[model samples]
Target: MSCSGFQPISLEKPTPEDEELSDKLMEKVRSVGGFDSEETKESKGAVLLKLDQIAKEFTELLSSAMSSTEQVSGECHIKILTSGLHGLGVPTNKPDIDVLFVGSRLVSRLRFFSLFYIMLRRKEGVKDTNAAPDAFVPVIRATVDNVEVDIVFAGFPSKDIIPGTLELRDDNILKGLDMESVRSLNWCRVNAEILHLVPEVDNFRNTLRAILVWAKRRGIYSSCLGFLGRMSYAILVAKICQLYPHALPSDLIKAFFELFSKWKWSWQCPVLLKPSTENWEFGDLAWDPRDNPKDRAHVMPIVYPIHPHINSTFNVTESSLQIMKKEFNEGFKVVSEVHNNEACWSKIFEEFKFFDEFQHFMVVTASAADDGRFRRWVGMVQSKIRNLVNFLEPRNCISSIRVNTEHFSPVSETNKYVRRWFVGLVSQRPLRAKDLRSPIDKFKSMTVLQARRVGFYTEDMKLEAAYVDRHQVEDMRKENSHFGAPTLSNTAAVGTGEQPSTSSVAEKTCQYDETTLPIPPKVRKTE
Candidate 1:
């Protein structure tokens, strides 16, 4: 196992004070929903069982449905396996169930996505199926039996084995795999590697659960908006646990904030549970700033432990980096004071006052014609919004930007599918909305331009960023803004009278790249 870190910074046991605090920490952690109950875990497992049956049925149906000319020479075996937090034996409430369909050489990914997608729609309780065959890691996202499931595909070089016979430890498992398949498998591989590398699985999991709750409540949990994700947080906690292998969960959590609050981060420094070098690596370039200049540009590199090591925090930007550092420093003070009996553990998990953090706020809104379209549109907007932050950084009038990672759905918008993301901004005094117009406009245009280039842009999709002041934000609070817009109309809202800006443009046809379009698959049913 590659769980050994660079070196043990300290192997000290927890002091009496830390142990005493731990008792309270565990209580507080449970109270704040840090861990899931037995009932919830069982419920999630049941849902996975249903998905497994559905997937197996789809595979059988696919064999009989495909043309003989298109079929492979041998039998196909497929296994549906779980990964991510649930796979790690620690899960949060409303967790997205991540699974992979591991197939023998006979099954291709194209068939898996298309046929299974069709199969899902035919099943009862399977809805909201969206296929992004051309995504960074192609996936068929769907909600099965009321549980969100992300299904990706990977094919073995030879015939797939029986369920429980395939082991990831064998380095030869990676040979001859396509890049997309390798990336898809990395999610499961890294999760397993982390479990192997941790000194104490229970303590590591407890610390991870507690830290995740704290990060989410503190508004620094999302990977989409340039902050540490669940896996990054896992790798980080595993590294810390390795350093203090003898400590309890309480002490490890304490050490986490204390060490990282003042951590000296640079291009050369990255948080790795195992060393960066691995023998299982495919030929793809790993995250080596010394060798690849582009890798050095990442602000917060939490290296994933697998072949072809990647920076989990590659999306992190300078402003987001500053925001996280500030949170860490504050967290250090809170955690340190707990040891001194000056503060309590509950104080550490307090919710981040995002709405009250700034003078001016920008409400980024996305509206589309349907739920599927809205979900797809929202994903595109969230991915590109970080670039908008990067663009605003060069402006002299703005000092900082804080994106609230949570998104909301409009409570009363019957006309369209709408979602809103609020951004907290710190302005350099003498604020003026007109000054932000050009940059805000650029952000909107860039979003649409990307949607166009990706061939997903549609006329019904609307993106807007309206600049509003503190007083106007209060009005929104009274209107129940957190859940969603109180009364969003197809028209617009006027008042604070802050005049929330509406972004729109003349409709134009998208110039889709003909070569990149996914071919629609045709299936023939057989009795």
Candidate 2:
């Protein structure tokens, strides 16, 4: 049993009557600006022009600025990878530009420091360096003509500087590179072929959106940053093209799932954590898991359903997985109910009349399913809907909604099973202080009321118990001098006739056999 069940139904290419229905459906898309919407075309054009202007301005600025700086020993080169090169067809509202700074001579330590200083000085007007450096970089973001451009300066002296220098240079270096040639590479061509293979546009957009959201939440949205975020998206897209040759967006997503499911390691974007363990920073890097002898170069998993530190960093009780399951189940119900009722489907179609080939497919599927007109139509509709659901099913789909670890790694067929288990754990049992680990080792954090809340302890009873425990501890310390041994000072003990050693009291109060506590039962596996 696949995530979406497989059902066989005969689907012959539409006859004349079916063609007529398709024509009518296509007309609806045209009315709504399906493939040839003027607004979409105009928007795309505007994005291209804006990117072009930015690239030109940047090149001009570098030419003038670098010429003046004698401290800069090499010729400055500007590389631009814009929407025009991505061939996304849609107009980009925020086009990403990759900038590289290449030098003729080896950059001295002093020169590198000077370069860093210049950037710091440039950002001084926008960001306060008094803040942590990691926190400051995100605030360093600036806009030129309403276009957000992220600039990274990589100084290269010679082509063969590092052992894997050529590969890295080829992957990242964009000096004197032809934009047209780069866009026309074997990979790009492969991507285009895959795009053509997609039968529906909606499925393509849905899959792309899912991947984007996943990347964004994980803090890996750009290829320039590392392999996990934007680079991962690109790699998946490229892989789709390579495997299917003419795969559609739905096909791509299905393929991605198939590939991802087979992966032994969890898929996570790696972030460079500070020594303080309070924050994370981005770098030009990739996963080098040398310890894994079989596939040493494979990327490490960074995306988890529930971040282990979910209680602390996110300040939410529910894990990312739990939220995703709830939302996905809800969405599934909505889709199913809408499909079951002809009037509801009609209402949806009336509002979103202007649909492309993709939209037509959805309507047809729904209509066919509801009408009980054709068996194949119903199966196709269900299959497509399941695919859509799977693409949008993950916790990352809903912005800022966290889920439990169980949601991502579900042990049951139904999400309800996981939800019930989570609720039972929080309600029936008290989560011990020791059980909650600090998201960061440096922080001596405890999962008190706040932590439990973030962990999705919605029940008022659970919250009340935590509060009660806290109040009891405070009251006990105040009332009983012997029981609440003051380790800090002898002031409290002085007032009492007898003084017990702080260590002795601590030993009596805190002593608990770890082996006696009952461990929570693991979730039953779904066959």
Candidate 3:
């Protein structure tokens, strides 16, 4: 199961063969859009550096503002909780900075956002700053120099002065805080906790980079759309490291898919490094399915290894969960093939058959007059597409509803930015017009209302819905030649909205799980 000479941190450096494999793996990832290229990484690092500087300046300004206020008795401090600084985040092209403002205990939550908003308005290069004090986790999301920055505020313990080295680990840090503050604190706390749990930093980072990109490409990565978020994926990878502390990136990557794909979800087991000791100490109840019915209802529970151990996959519903499971199974088989020399590593991250999979497709198109308007309009529609999926699941005739993560731009003279997402549909019985009408109408109404509620409704913005046959999809794909391969090479792999199960065929020829690695005691027994 394990590759030789690929020891954890003790190994001086990867051996020649190990290095070759690593380079090959990373290169394969890059080819299939599973990992960022070196150029992309370097560019992202530059942006992050600039973001770090901006965050520092913003913090200083906030501290000055708080100190000037009559309501503040003592000094207020602000710090940018950099994930890269702490080796917590995999290097990514996305510029999402989590900025924490530590203020005096006397300062109110409302005052924090209000003051931050004012400071943002005065600052040059800052735009789209919105302050929602009433939000469950009060945050000020804004763009500085076109990079997204998320700002959260937390106060010092009681009337105590802020320390130069403030660690959120102190039990008193979150004490007497409202739910929103506690939630906000978790952004930093959880990141810190995950970093602490991971044994091999390099192995964890590299393997996670592959998994994260793969998940995103597979379309099962969106947290906003009831799928695994970054934090949840981090927790899962960290747990794998706990089990195999010394495994290299290659071994860990194989083990990652193997372990999760075989995971017994019906048991309702939670993945944890160790039994959670975060109990009523912080006035929060740790997740225990036996006692909390809410915990029992989670379709897929990946418990965070921290206080109040919330299920990071709480947003997952039955439909999304199934989709994720099928994807995991596919990933497991593909990796198995690469290991057996039956296929290249690229096969593991190959694009799935989305539009061409089923006989009929639900084509939902959102068009806008400009790129800016289209981005906002499409984003709102994408976030709420899960609602449409959930609504379709209960109907008896529907086999599966698969959403295309990649949208297409259909031809339109008036529409400057036209993005269309296809929802592949498979029916248990013969397709009937009457059965499809009700769900389509319901989906249309929900999308339209959501667009209007989110202020995306305009004369320039439009929504189009239609059910197209396979021949129509082929014609559309032919029309758009710039898009990648229009069809999967293996026709057998294309069927039923669910990904075709290749593991059964892969198993006949390949011994993917030849190594009998011992499962950890904690992993075997439910807590």
Which numbered prediction scores highest in TM-score against the true structure? 1
Candidate 2 residue lDDT tens string, 250-341? 33444554543343332232211111121112111112233234223223332111101111111112232243334334333433443344
Better of 1 and 3 by lDDT: 1
lDDT per model vs. reference: 0.70, 0.27, 0.60
Task: Encode model 1's per-residue lDDT on 1-527: one tens digit a residue.
Answer: 12234778788877887677777898898897777777767777887888788768866766555444465455656887776677777776653577877887767787676666666766888777766555556666667777766677888766644356556644567788886677677767887888888888988988888888888888887666667777778888998888888888888888888777667676667888766665345433457787678777888788877776777777789999999989888988898888788988889999898887888888888888877667667767766677778878888889999988777765555644777778888888867878778878898998898778766688999999888888986765564434621110000111100010112111111222323433233343331
Candidates by lDDT, descending order: 1, 3, 2
Off by over 4 Å in 2: 1-76, 83-140, 155-230, 237-241, 251-428, 432-527
Any residue pairs clashing in model 3, and if so which? none
Q: Best lDDT goes to which candidate?
A: 1
List the candidates' TM-scores in order: 0.88, 0.35, 0.74
lDDT measured at residue 2 in model 2 versus the true structure, 0 to 100: 20
Q: Mark the 10 consecutive residues where model 3 has the least summed lDDT.
A: 488-497
Give stretches of model 1 more than 4 Å off: 1-5, 15-17, 65-72, 160-163, 278-285, 413-416, 480-523
